[model samples]
Target: MVDFNSTSFHPATFQLTGFPGQEAAHHWISIPFCVVYITAIVGNCTVLCIIWAERRLHQPMYLFLCMLSVNDLGMSLSTLPTVLGIFCFDVTDVAFDACLAQMFFIHSFSFMESGILLAMSFDRFVAICNPLRYAAILTNPRIVRIGLAVVIKSTSMLLPFPFLIKWLPICKGNVLSHPYCLHSDMMRLACADTTVNNIYGLFATLVTYGLDSVFIILSYVKILRTVFNIASYEQRLMALNTCVSHICAVLLFYVPIIAVAVMHRFGKSAPRLVQILLSYACLFVPPVLNPIVYSVKTKEIRKGISRIFSRDFL
Candidate 1:
């Protein structure tokens, strides 16, 4: 272990924040944080295990759900360390390189989640609009390809973001917005020109989430059209119901994200605590709630869960 006092340190450590003015309550608030973190990890892991064990779910939809769970797992694990370090241990100072690594993983997984959502929407599209050809369209190899593409797209685009922010001289003092590193939060601390960073960051967001969101919306619109063309009310309800979990997942991921963005841009005069809380909520809520939504909304997943438990009990 490198002693902080013994040798001259490097990489310019940054202080992570819990709540700006409510530092005293950080530990107390950690109770809920700990609960959410454990629930997200355990819930996503359980979803993954169920999908893996049950061969009946070996379809495009279930495969995409597995990918979503894996991405959620990555997102939870990505930020867990810094959160626990700051809240539980009061270890706030993080080496700059470590911060960048953490940022890369967090943002990369975020982008991956978006990509997976888009892929999931497409899976729903094919299943609903072209049920006969769904298997032909989303073959096992094709799903693997989409998964690889999501990983590649996220990693490649976000890889430069850290290097872009890192070389900049952090003369503004390396304090971050929340208990973790965000590219937007980190860029503000740079003394050097951030025009390139901002441009590229915006570019990445547009290309990734913006484009994905558009396609997702279009896919749903088409699904609705297809569903409505059918005469039977029960059939329409069943068709639309299939999308409920994914829609909830989308909202859970995006709503607070929009709140955080709005707070940062327009709510500058807003309390630092407000912004921090929303940021944390955006990252934490989706992973924790998604597995629950899918497991509850999708009967197959719930049945698998019940069967697993019943077997273990026996």
Candidate 2:
């Protein structure tokens, strides 16, 4: 029988030669990322404050929106600090345990965000499809329940990831290619055979992200159908407009994810820099863009944000 914790197993290893001698580009990238990180924090914080203060915005839809803002804040916070640390201080050597922890949170928050998006889609579906039942279906108690479920489900699904890494005997390679430890990337460093890990990873991805995406698409499809069957052209237009921002947000988050997945699978021997850049963009861009899309498209949020700023300055 193979001992799981045996130290005799040789670790699979790789090194991230920092930016391939282009330290200048690495420094330059930090400036834009820093600006985006600050903006995302401010924007998400404003959303949260407004949602908290305003009684009118306390419904299920807005509740989900607030949760989404919180998730985005978490997603940004998980990665940006480490990224900035790498760029500013050249402190890239992360301990093995720290890397596993980072990977766990990154994956957990990512799944949480996906769950929030699914919840938002359900909110919109009810609002459009069964307007009369909307309030009853989405009461304060129910919303709270769903929120708890999101947290519980996301946390449960990703809990095994870090623990799995911790149990493995890491015999080689401490340097990660990216600023944060990505699950797949980290798995490559394990000395043990990763067939089980890969299978479980794919399962998690399919169930959480993949299933949520399918449900979101179906919700929008029904929403679009309902809108088209409406008698009023203005109503159809308004419904379509409401969905535009959501569609854009989904695309922004998922397109880069798909791109990175494809690159990882098919772009074997692709330059290390390309892989790192793709991963970095996937992590940072969606959080930066989510608040912008919502604020620009949702008048209530925009006005609420404006009021928040005005009151703060005055």
Candidate 3:
């Protein structure tokens, strides 16, 4: 190991761990991981393809979904290599730069997902709360700008992470906590002062998770008020029904995130397996479930999927 105390010190490679002290079970564990990866890839790709092929689905809601699918795919592929390496091939070494890149993409995509969900919430808000203006407000040009804003905002927020990480000298062993690299985990390994990193991380978290979540809640509050004012019971149910998929998607994305955050903060005495499993849930669950939830809950998506399958195979 190079002298980490030196100003110019940097690690060439970092060791990645799958399950701590569970090497024997890595092969077994790879099964579920593989299943999740396969499902996430196929599911998200199918969503994207269906949304793309169904010209009728080129609305603000489906457009936001397309962005979500893309983000899910990015997050899944970002972790695939290190995860497969550790579990399947037993190769744990990852180049430092590669590790940083993976961390960057994973976190950026995560932020993008949050932003997309917030945008979806806004879509629902406009559709239900202000139905007449929905079309005029969420035009194709406006949707494109929102999508671009989400991408740029998420990527820009995370852009400083790599340089910030590289600046710190890591006297601690370069062994990552999980198969995939994470910004928080990387900061933990650095021996130098990480106050700036921590502060910036907190800032990013507040900007993405905190602000986006608040906006989503406010949008829903407005939606509920608008729905309640409708005269007919069936109309209210129909209005709320339209949001079921998006609501599921939001909860699926955020609940695990909240759990992981709580575990990191309060579950210091929690088992290592619990921590790792929760981390996996945060990364894997949303991507796998979002597409399935949308397909199950939205009639249009179901029809689109069936149409594609019938045309291609039957």
Find the candidate with the highest lDDT and give its number.
3
- lDDT by residue (tens digit), candidate 3, 265-298: 9998999888888999989999899999999999
Clashing pairs in 3: none
lDDT of 2 by residue, 93-144 (tens): 6655566677888888888888888888898889888889999999999898
lDDT of candidate 1 at residue 262, scale 0 to 100: 84
Better of 2 and 3 by TM-score: 3
What TM-score would every model get versus the actual structure? 0.95, 0.90, 0.96
Say which candidate scores most in TM-score: 3
Cα TM-score of candidate 3: 0.96
Which runs of model 3 end up more than 4 angstroms from their true locations? 1-7
The deviation in Å at residue 62 for candidate 1 is 0.7
* Clash count, candidate 3: 0
On the 0 to 100 scale, the lDDT of residue 150 in model 2 is 93
- Candidate 3 structure lDDT: 0.92
Location of the lowest summed lDDT over 10 successive residues in candidate 3: 1-10
